[model samples]
Target: MEHVGVEQFPPDKTGDAMTTALLHLENHYWTESEYLAIGETPERIELFDGSLVVTPTPTVGHQYIVSRLVVSLYEVARSAGLHAFAGLGIRLGPGHIRIPDFLITTELNFDDRVNDSDVVKLICEVISPSNASTDTVQKMRHYADAGIPWYLLIDPRSETFHLFRLDGDRYTEHAKAAPGELLELTEPVVATIDPAELLPPR
Candidate 1:
């Protein structure tokens, strides 16, 4: 696969020519070849702010949490006449981003707006120990920068969850879900979930 030109990965920002010139990254010319060069698959991947980030399958506990959360979100959205999908490819841009967890997309008809399923109204991640820090600080900023409306983090270690809502081009802590508690997020979309329901039983 050829690399994408800066214009190809346009964010909400400008300076397309300058952005392309600044990056020595893969050119849109032969993206197929470059993708093969990566030489790894089956691992979860995401293009964050136009950079590739790989995440492997989670632990059994992580999977359990992700599964339950996905099911619940899907059920809720379906009832509301909205759409919720888990582990469906979402285009986060830079490379194909696959969040092994789940996402809630809004479009009645999915489009590759932000990278597959432009309608993604919400995103959720189960933070295993290996990704605690990055999930906390790194992802917090990245999703916000991407202009994602809602971001949820499921932290098993502490048996906690955090929800951030886009506030003025950035994410502000929308809710913190502790064990046995259900946190609510009702903006850019309206939904509520219980972190404990997604946590692995002790």
Candidate 2:
């Protein structure tokens, strides 16, 4: 699984020191029920490389970008007969996971997000400067590993949105589309979009 640096909190004895039985989970596979059952502590629990990472609250700029990305993504995807969800967790590996900003599935028969099933056609991340590593590195690796056919990243700092095409277990750089450029995706679904409209004007 790809790893963005894990978020660590100040050590506290109140955590109960509950060590997980992570027996040889190196290839990044996990069940949904097992994932939610772990680490119920108030701290943000993110699954990383077979462990739980306590993440921090994202910054305001990060949130602004996320909100704008959501609106744009929803508009484009829905018009094209796709389904998308925000803040949904996906199993990437044994202990590796991701809760993409938006998850879009184009398969007509795979419309199970409101119920069950883990596979998705595409995953998107709204990137902030703080999440450079995760968006570029960690997510790129895991999304590819998970066989998610399309990956889109919205980077406010770059003033760009990236659309990746999955090739086997890795991604090929499909386009680093400028705000107004439309990216045409060829995958389990087909989507034409301009990411520039996804962000507030610069």
RMSD in angstroms, all models? 9.5, 7.5
Score candidate 1 by TM-score against the native. Answer: 0.69
Count of steric clashes across candidates, in order: 16, 6
Q: TM-score per candidate, in order?
A: 0.69, 0.66
Q: How well does candidate 2 match the true structure in TM-score terms?
A: 0.66
* Alpha-carbon runs more than 4 Å astray in model 2: 1-35, 38-44, 75-81, 106-118, 186-191
What is candidate 2's lDDT per residue for 144-179, written digit by digit as tens?
A: 777778788877777777878888889987877775
Which residue runs does candidate 1 get wrong by more than 4 Å?
Answer: 1-41, 47-52, 94-100, 108-117, 188-191
Q: RMSD of model 2, in Å?
A: 7.5
Cα lDDT, model 2, residue 141: 82
Clashing pairs in model 2, backbone N/Cα/C closer than 3 A: 28-93, 28-94, 29-93, 29-94, 50-95, 179-196
Residue 12 Cα positional deviation in candidate 1, in Å, after optimal superposition: 41
Top-scoring candidate (TM-score): 1
